[model samples]
Target: MSLPALSPYHLSLALTLPGLLLLWRNLRFRFYASRRARKIPHAQERVLILGASSGVGRSVAHVYVKRGAKVCIVGRRRDKLDDVARECRAMARGGAQVLMVKADCADPEEMVSLRERLEEEWQGLDTVIITAGVSALRPMMSNAGVEMDPRHPPKSQATAEGLTHAISVSNAAITGNFTGPLVSALSLIPLLTLTSRSPSILLLSSAAAVIPAPTRALYAATKAASLLLYQALAIEHPQIAFTFFLAGTIEGDFRASAVDKALPPNLTSSGSGSDSSEPTPLVREANPAKHGLKVGWVAQRCAQAVDRGEKNVFTPMYMRFGHLFYWIVPAYVEWRARVKYRYT
Candidate 1:
């Protein structure tokens, strides 16, 4: 069937409407950025960070310390926590207070004790950033030590051992990526709401939470769970600002600490260049230190997002489009993911 052609005015309106919307969005972002800059973290502000012993959490602690915020870093390793606390102190030039608490965020008892300590020491909390997460780099079936041929599928009972292994791996991922943040949030929300005029919580989530990828079955599922939990919290408590930092691959030893203990292929290669043709590098790459976003850069951006009370922030900004593209062409996205992770 032939349809009537649009008028020139209709064509002009179609093109102009998108440009106007883009212009409006740009202006709004700038407005909030400027407003947030004026209210950066102050010396008296108290920030409690979980999993601050290493990776993004450690870098974020340094960022807040430089801003003169009274920062408390919590982690399971006392030695690493001490190192982070010392580094934060050095970064602060002795101007900011750094508190180190050795506690597991996933442990409900530990979280409760940590919250009580913060209440007694700081009297309240202004900001809470949960960055503790474990990555899994094996495909769903491989995680269970199973390799199946579609044409000759094994009986369901034959996969019992593989299922057991998968469950164990899944548990670790859930504890680190989901339970930790859930416990910490439940313990600290009251303190945040009661103590600070501008209470903010930043969850260091990943693009995997929203965009499906190869070798991320458990990691993505767990992260998505926590991401939704905080999202629900945001709606339930409108007074406290919640920012979900949906970052892509970040330069660090994060993968080294994956629950699966299976690093991506070519883990040691030193390729630093990202493909300029792609909108964003949302795939696993070799030597994240060379190819991924700098840890410090991400931390600074995260702090800025918190200061701005941003709801969801995607690092490199272009990664935000990935969600739209995935929704439109999921198979294409999955194929690219398989290629990046070297699954095919």
Candidate 2:
């Protein structure tokens, strides 16, 4: 059976509809942006940023510091936190306070103590930005060949060791990417709800959460968990504003500290080195000439999204189409992802 070809009217409609929809979306975004710009400035607002010692967290701290916000930066490394605090203070406007705290976001007791400290010092909290997450660049089945039988797993010494290492790496990703942010949010939401009129929480998520990609199974799963956690929180708390910043690849050394120990060091720009109490060089340095978006620009966009109370923000703008594209063409998306991530 032969089918009739599409008419010119149908082809024209197919081409024109997308353009009209895009124009409508742009207008709507501009309308909301203008409204948000007129809101109260961040001057004197209390903000707490987790994982602020490096990467996007540090950049976000700079953004809020310039806006004259009382910023508290938290991270496990005290030396790095101090360096960030110093930078924030230097950039502070209108006496913006920069407090550096050494703590792990996955620790409940530490989060409690942090909440108490904020209450004591700042009286309340207005914003909380969570950017503490580890990256994974290895496939999920990288070590599966060592122990194929689930019923008789870890039969040999080599297999046992391999499995143990793989599990540890997976645990690190979950703890850093999901559990840590969940703990921090649970501890701080109460204070935010009680204190601020327009409480905001910005989560530095990744586009991988929605778009599947090779070598990103663990990373995407954990990030998706965190994203959904915040989305649920948004539904439960109507007064608080939540912004999930789903960013694409940024020009930085973030891969240096990936949880996947099996990944070759050469694949990353540089190694962060072993953990030390002393002040060591920062791992996540930004390179403007590198591929992808700039860290500073992404940070500014995150801040703007929080101010506007936007539910989801996709950087590079075009990343918003990724989900739809993947839905329409799964094989092509998978192939592109493999090529981009350098996975076979």
Candidate 3:
């Protein structure tokens, strides 16, 4: 069967609907944003932020404190936490308190203690934002990087091995990025003193959950698993508002930290020097500048989502389309990935 060629009018007609839809969406978003801006009034709030020492966590802490929220910042680094606490204190408005708690998210005991400490210090929490996660970029899953080559010997192997082991153990256990936040949220939710009618448990996820990019199999798997857990939790626990911030690459120190914790392959064997200690091999990292979003913008968007009691959110909102597109035509996405990321 032969099809008739489209005339100029037909082509124009085809574009009309899409153009109208775009205009409508823009207007709707503007109205929605304005209403949310007015709705989320500044007042004292009890907020617990995990991994708030730096990056998106720190940005969110600053936003909350600026609006007169009592913020508790948690991270493994005491010094970084203290620095974030100091910044939060300075940024705080009227009577906003900033507290720093040093703890590891992967540690059940530490997490339990964190819950107990929060219970003692504050009556309840209004919001719990968990943004602690680890991701390493490697060309392949098995090899950490070329750092294990004989040309390079590490000054510290025990520490690297220990950290890598912990990351590995957590990845396998439910307590890693997969369920650590969930467990932490569950422990803290019980102590939630709801300031507003809707209390929120916000998880900071990644777009990798749905994108399925290369070189991030473990990272993407963990994040996707976490989303599923939270989505199910949302249905099970209807009393609390459980939301996810599915973020893209953001301008933060997360990448740097992940790289630092990344251990060289055969770290145990490579730790010992052979007469001459070779210089540490540097892992080639992608410049996140290509895809990074500003931490402040992401924080603000997340804050609005929490206030609006949204269920799922994507930073740089347009990324939401990619999720829908992937679901609608998964084969297209797979083909695109294979072409762009060179995934076999």
Candidate 4:
């Protein structure tokens, strides 16, 4: 039924609204899919994790262990990695091998070493989940050392191998996490059994990435750059999915020591850190892997997303809307976040 001829503005709105609606619905469906998959059983596969000793990485290790996936734990903390491996062994169904390889994520050579080690044992790697990352929360304004510089920053840090930790992690997501993982899963593609032809590279970006935080310049820049790269990669490869998980304000141990000491009671309800009202010591949210996202929760949802072969995931729900807000009301968002977090 033809009603009336639409103006350019009307046509624009009409075209735009539906597209926005479709995107909203699609994201909503995936979110629900992730929620539902939480209820089902996890399918087992061999897994390797970086920064496997603590936080979300460790939690993911625990989740996979329960599912009978043999896990290889990698981190600088040999003892902690060993402990996690021992625990996984006790919980194994098929009795998974927990190879504790001590390598620094900041050092590319160390990472290369770890890869070589993997090659030595396994014919091929099934999955590699990298949760190894570090952050400095000293508002990035001052070169205040929130995190001490290790004499030798691991492969996760800027390694002697000429790769910055940011580059290794983000660029790795582009090549290995997204593209490489898909090709590796080719065997399962025929069955669409273990995982669909739809391979996925799930990355942990931040809410600060979308909405620029003053002190998080480098961290945000790196994450933003990687996020865009994923979009391009996804466009080029439709069959393989590129998933970026934009994690939001999760209170965890990784907050800068001084900031952690200043959080108010309401913010630090658990009595772990200080409140926002206090003077912020550091700026960029340290050891993002340490806190912010619930380790077990993220692990569970990650498994769910892996199982469903979903494309993208932005957690805490606010992030989906945030993508819109950051575009439309960026200044206000920045102002509020600064005031709210009380960045000096």
Could you estimate the TM-score for every candidate? 0.84, 0.81, 0.74, 0.62
Which rank order by TM-score, best down to worst?
1, 2, 3, 4
Better of 2 and 4 by TM-score: 2
Tens-digit lDDT track of model 4 for 1-344: 98899999999998899999989877876875564345332343556676677767777788887876657787778887878888877876665566778866655566666666666765335555656555434332122212222132222221232223333433433442233323322322222223322234455556666767765655565556656665675677565444566777655553431221222222211211222223334543344456466667887877666555555677877777867887888887777666655553
Per-residue lDDT of model 3, residues 1-344, tens digit only: 99998999999989798999978866765665455446434564678899888888889999999988778899988988888988887788987888789998877788889877877787666788888887755433223222233334544334544556545634553345766776676666667634334467889999888787655566677788888888887887787877888987787667665433444444432333344444332233344555579888888887777766677788767678778889898888767655554433
Best by lDDT: 1
For each candidate in the order shown, give its overall lDDT on alpha carbons. Answer: 0.79, 0.79, 0.71, 0.55
Clashes of 3: 0
C-alpha displacement of 66 in model 2, angstroms? Answer: 1.0
| Best-fitting candidate, scored by TM-score | 1
- Residue by residue across 1-344, what tens digits does model 1's lDDT show? 99999999999999899999988876776776565455543776788888899998999999888878889998888888888888888879445889889999899998899888988988988889989878887656655554333234432222455567778889999999988888888888888888777788999999989988777878899999999999999999999889999998888878877787642332211221322222112234566778889998898888878876678898768778888789899888888777767655
- The C-alpha RMSD of each candidate to the native structure, in angstroms, is 7.1, 7.5, 6.7, 11.2
Q: Which stretches of candidate 1 lie over 4 Å from their true place?
A: 1-41, 148-158, 262-284
Residue 223 of model 2 has an lDDT of: 97
TM for candidate 2 is: 0.81
Residue 293 of model 2 has an lDDT of 87
